[model samples]
Target: MTQPSPLSDRRVVLAVAVLCCFLWGSAVPALKIGYGVFGIVPSDTATLLLFAGVRFSLAGALLLGYALATGKPVGLDRRTLGRVSLLGLVSTAGQYLFYYVGLAHSTGVKTSITTSSSTFFSAILAHWLYTNDKLTGRRLVGCLLGFAGVVAVNLSGAGLDLAFSVLGEGFILIAALLFSLGGIYGKRVSGQLDVMVMTGWQLGLGGLMLAVAGLATGGHLGGFGWEGVLLLAYLAALSSAAFALWALLLKHNPVGSVAIFNCLIPVFGVSLSGLVLGESFLEWKNLVALALVSVGIWLATARKDSVVGRPSP
Candidate 1:
């Protein structure tokens, strides 16, 4: 008898997926602190890219090192090399480029809502790409619930605005679209390459592109005091762990199943940002957002049978 892989279990998938989202959510505050510690102004797009590049570069190095230490093949053939690099550029470099710049031009509330659209994008893209991963009523309802939670979490203060700009919400939407496309592309590539090695290369290569572009655009990064060093290290650590887990999940599960958890990122991001930055996060909206997202996750992943991502062909 063949034993089912642990990742095929819904409970394990939920735990790992949530953990990955939590780590990513914490990056919100850590990034703010990082900017202050390193003296990066909001308008300094060059420095922002440089900082992101360094963090992702270090993260890639960490994963690659671990892969090497564990005796996994990190070397890529020519065919796979190009594919991985393109994935890196689209998913990492291109996505973050728009994200950082757009964030500067948009409000945080708007940004959160805009980026949450990636979950929907992933679901829709999955519907077209995978025969078995059709967008059903349950999936649609679950996505709507999750998106409502995202909106609820960001309903603090002035609430959402009608104003939109190309550089602001527009760029973020592009990032979200790229993220969805990248996840699908990555799933296809992961079948041809080791997940760890592919992720490491994409991060490393994409980060290198960002670093070079930042430098060409007059970006400078320094002032690595012990605090700064530790902060950067923490950011890198989180990226490496979170991205690797996410890629692993995508490899084994449907994009909609795993990608739906993205809504929780804002929930955790808002809560942790408030806690760390001394802002109020215990408001009714936050609680409501959490409840909505929880139910959404349950609805998205709830299945009658033990079968998980794969269905009968």
Candidate 2:
């Protein structure tokens, strides 16, 4: 197999990272539409799990199929299997379990803002886990700017709420933390395993667990239709592509560098929600938020010597 270029190649990293974040951003609206098509109300915990289980399981299958077709090795050693399964559990099943329930209890705006905290978690974790990815002033400023953009974009819809719930905001934070940990762990695993293969197995194993739990709890989609199936398929494809690419990126880049892109997810989510759900798209804050996010990405990812297109010192 040909060795891929280092993620320090700014152009390739930016393109792939943007694509991954855009796919994830689209999921926000896609999932909202999916819930309606599948007749899953906010209170439908079991059905939500069932829906997510199906989506992820299918995504795993698609990734594995792609790997086989592309002649990538699909076999994993027993130890690798165990590690990948653990990664899947924390990253996919556990993260989404909390996320779905939390989103159900909280508003979409709040969910987006809270989940954006994962970048902070990842940056902090990387400082401890990776010597090369130490926390720096530039990275901190970038993360804060991106976080502010997230807050700015959601400000219109997120009316002040003094009340907070453990199940609502708390779970979202937990999911964010778990997601950060999962990214770090995934980087470790990808060093030894093929990125696609690792992603496929973990998603399959974790998704199977979710399916079993949902089924055991009497989860079933009501009024299943062709539209619902198609949407589910779309979601699965997004997961397979985004996660595999993400794993690959994390394997080659500093965790903080790649993790900073997570801030883009909510930006894409808000913009898409406006277009798809007929919300106002002309808000001034939206533009400001995007500008801030752009600056944030630049600051976080740009090499010190390359800041002004200068060669390394």
Candidate 3:
């Protein structure tokens, strides 16, 4: 019999999930700053891949080391190794391949808004994949409301740009879809695996694939300094922490219930990106967006009679 996770508690879920969102949200600005520090131009696809690859590789190493140091089981059988490797490919490597490239071509605000669509994707997938997690009217409304906030963030100034680019917003949407699918798979696999070990292996294997791809395609990264190294370390640290925590949450909760918190990422991303990257964020729409997303979160998670953490009958 599987022991219940303390993370399944609603309050703990809310707190830790929000913490994950905050960490992920801060990644927007951090990544952009990393680009500058490493002297990666927008056109440098190979180097971009290399940079992302290295960050995840280090993150994976950190998690694996921590898992071992803490006396957690780190050994995997062939079947489990295959599963974790696939997860690494889909969740980390595949998603970030598009994400890193997409971010290079789009503004942080725009990228954040677009990627927020992953919430909806996860919700839709969970609706089909899990009986207990069927998409209810309340959940739909909550998702829409949260998504409305995502839209409102860009409505300020000249309003949202209607322009779409294959390499920009298009790639971001693809990444979102990949991430949603990966979440479902991760949830399924975590049922029998230690969340920490699973997350670490996936990150390490996926990151290694990315690094190899970047190198094979002639991606080279240079311009290393103390600042650059430190920034890279921070990115790695944040990924290690946030991803490990998120995997634990998914191990205990419904995908929709947990994924709804992704709406908060853009809220944090826009605000942080504006402050850190010198983009405009002090618009009236931002406050309205925040309110809508907050209500959406409450509606999604605060069900009085919800059996959210249970598996389907």
- Per-residue lDDT tens digits for candidate 1, residues 181-266, read 88889988988898899999989988898998889899998789999999999999999899888998888788888888999999
What is the descending lDDT order?
A: 1, 3, 2
Inter-residue clash pairs, candidate 2: none
Candidate 1 vs candidate 3, TM-score winner: 1
**Local distance difference test, candidate 3:** 0.87
| Reference-based TM-score, model 2 | 0.93
Per-candidate local distance difference test: 0.90, 0.85, 0.87
Highest TM-score, which number? 1
> What is the lDDT, from 0 to 100, of the residue 128 in candidate 2?
79
User: What would the TM-score be for candidate 1 when compared with the true structure?
Assistant: 0.96
The reply for model 1, stretches above 4 Å from the true place, is: 1-3, 304-313
TM-scores of the candidates in the order shown:
0.96, 0.93, 0.93
After superposing all C-alphas onto the true structure, candidate 3 shows an RMSD in angstroms of 2.1
lDDT of 3 at 238: 92
lDDT of 3 by residue, 1-313 (tens): 5665678888999999999999988988998888888888867888888888999999999999998999998999999999999999999999989987898788766887898899999999888877778788998889999998888876755776768899999999999999998888998888789888899998999999999989998998887899988998999999999999998888778888888899988888889999998988888889999999999998888773333345556
On TM-score, the stronger of 1 and 2 is 1
